[model samples]
Target: MVRGKTEVRRIENAASRQVTFSKRRNGLLKKAYELSVLCDAEVALIVFSSRGKLWEFSSSSRKLLGETLGTCSAAELHELGNQLEESLRQIRKRKQCILAEQIAELREKEKSLLKENKLLHEKFKGGNMLHLNAAEVQSMEVNTQLMIGRPGTL
Candidate 1:
């Protein structure tokens, strides 16, 4: 019997975690070897430590099993990566298309505003010309009064 069962969650105390990992790793390798010998079966196992160290064992011919498993793993990873990349590409294209439509809408609004401004400018110009003609008539009346300074000349 042992003291307590260990949880899979991270161990806050580094020293305890290291001790546990060492014990468990040895036991796992021993079990794999025993199973292979007793059952006359092939076994392959790979483990990576928290520190990135790799551990592996195979009961069958190492060359044959390693080649076969490696090939399959590569193929599966390639397929998964392709799927993820295609999904991302589709998302980006949709975003670009939406932005393009927004830009077109803004351009149409700008054109409408420009046409309204042109009409306002034309109205202002016409009103200003009318005021100028009225001023000219007032000047002409003042000149006529000066020319008829003598009452008999009227």
Candidate 2:
């Protein structure tokens, strides 16, 4: 007969729960050991029981793991810091180049606009105009002259 799948939930009986925990913990430790041996890999396992009992397994000694990991982490952190600093430097350089390019483009546009404005002013001044009085024309001419000499005039 095909058995139905067991519903996984917390065991209500304290004795059954303890038995299950013991079985599972042993199975897990066995698997960990098998994996380390078969793969020739470093493995560590730590388990705590409800009774505050601690179980641990490691392919390497705890002191060796601590020392090696501490040194590796420090070296890795230093390398990472250097890489980040270099990346930031490169980013700043690229940003400066982009800003310079934008500034040059804006300067060129400003110059073009100023030239256009000067031409328009000259055209207006040369044409006969009955609407503008002498003072208005003089004021316009003075403003045009000021704008032409300025560096950032639009």
User: Which is the leading candidate under lDDT?
Assistant: 2
Query: lDDT scores for all predictions?
Result: 0.74, 0.78
**Predicted candidate 1, C-alpha RMSD:** 26.0
The most accurate candidate by TM-score is 2
User: Global lDDT for candidate 2?
Assistant: 0.78
Q: Each candidate: RMSD to true structure? A: 26.0, 24.9
Residue ranges of candidate 1 with Cα displaced over 4 Å: 1-8, 63-154
Clashing pairs in 1: none
lDDT over C-alpha atoms for residue 95 of model 1: 76
Q: lDDT by residue for model 2 over 1-154, one digit each (tens)?
A: 9999989876999999999999999999999899889999877777879788988787753533233545456776676567557867997999799899879999999999999999888887788554688987787743354445658756
Candidates in order, TM-scores: namely 0.39, 0.40
Q: Which tens-of-lDDT digit does each residue in 1-154 have in candidate 1?
A: 7778746665779998889888988889888888999999876666668999887777874533235545457676676567557867997999799899879989999999999988888887876744567667577543354453766766
Model 1, position 78: C-alpha lDDT score: 73
